[model samples]
Target: MTLKQQLTDDMKTAMRGGDKHRLGVIRLVLAAIKQREVDERIELDDAQTLAVLEKMLKQRKDSVSQYEAADRQDLADVERAEMTVIEAYLPAKLDDAELDALIAAAIAETGASGPRDMGKVVAAVKEKAAGRADMAVVSGKIKTRLAG
Candidate 1:
């Protein structure tokens, strides 16, 4: 099944199982996906859906950080749980060493020379690693490579 269909089925399962937390997160994801479809007037493919899931996960990560900074452990816990749910829909992430190697290859392939080449390098990396790696980390590696 497609990722979107799987999510819908999961939502139904969560409801049947009376999983309130999981259901809430699933609903949020479904709503986000639906909103994007409505706004764009096109159905999202798996990659597009994964992009949306990644964005939601990133938002939860930021919320988790803010909640922790405010000493709101309860809120942070909720965000964390939501992250766990969202992450299940994403592909496995590349480890730092693996990510670095991929970035290095992209930089070389694109002949990225310095900070001016950061955009080119990022575009290449995104083509190869978008759903499999975090862009923030990829950009950091690119910056360090360019600086040195």
Candidate 2:
């Protein structure tokens, strides 16, 4: 089944199990997906769906950090819980070594050398590694590789 179908099925299961928190998160994801489809006038494939989930996960991470900085443990906990739910839908993330390997391959494939070629390298990396690796980490790796 497609990712979107799986999400819909999971939502139904959550409702049946009285899992309010999980259900709410699933609905939020579905709504976000729907909004994108409406706005773009295009159906989202699995890759696009994964991208949306990744975006939501990033937002939750940002919210968690902001909440913690403000000493709002309760709010932070909520964001953390939501993040956990969101993450469950994502594919397994790449570790640092694997991410680096992908980045090296991308740099080589693009013949990217020095800081001037950073954008080209990043675009290639994003095409290959989006949703699998953290872009911030990938960006840092690109900077280091270029600087060296």
Candidate 3:
């Protein structure tokens, strides 16, 4: 089944299980996906759906940090909960060694030689990550490799 269908099935399960927290998060995810489809006038494939989930995860991460910095642990906890639910659908995150290998491969594949080639390397790695990478971290690594 498609990712969207999986989300719908999980939503029903959560409802029947009386898991309000999970149900709310799932609804929010579905709403976000629907909004994107309405705005773009196209149905999202699995990759595109994954991209939306990643975007939501990033937003939740940012909110969690900001809430904590503002001394609002309660709010931060809510964001963290939402993040966990959203992350359930994403692929397993890459570890440091794997990420480094992927970056090296991207750089080599792109024939990236210097800082001027940063975009190509980043694009290659981003494609490999399927929009799942923390771009800030990836770009920093790419810059260091190229500039050094």
Clashes of each: 0, 0, 0
In model 3, residue pairs whose N, Cα or C atoms come closer than 3 Å (at least 3 residues apart or on different chains), thus clashing, are none
> Candidate 1, residues 1-148: lDDT per residue as tens digits?
9999999999999999999999999999999999999999999999899999999998999999999999999999989998999999999999988888888898889998889999999999898886999898888889999989
- Per-candidate TM-scores read 0.92, 0.95, 0.95
TM-score pick, better of 1 and 2 = 2
Q: lDDT per residue, candidate 3, 36-127, as tens digits?
A: 99999999999899999999999999899999999999999999999999999998888778888999999899899999999999989988
Order by TM-score, highest first: 2, 3, 1
Alpha carbon lDDT at 31, candidate 3? 95
Model 2, residue 58: C-alpha shift (Å):
1.2
- Candidate 2 has a TM-score of 0.95
lDDT of 2 at 123: 94
- lDDT for residue 22 in candidate 3, whole number 0-100: 99
Residue 50 error for model 2, in Å? 1.3
Q: Which pairs of residues collide in model 1? A: none
lDDT against the true structure, per candidate, is 0.93, 0.93, 0.92
Q: Mind sharing the TM-score for model 3?
A: 0.95
What RMSD, rounded to one decimal, does every model reach? Answer: 1.3, 1.0, 1.1
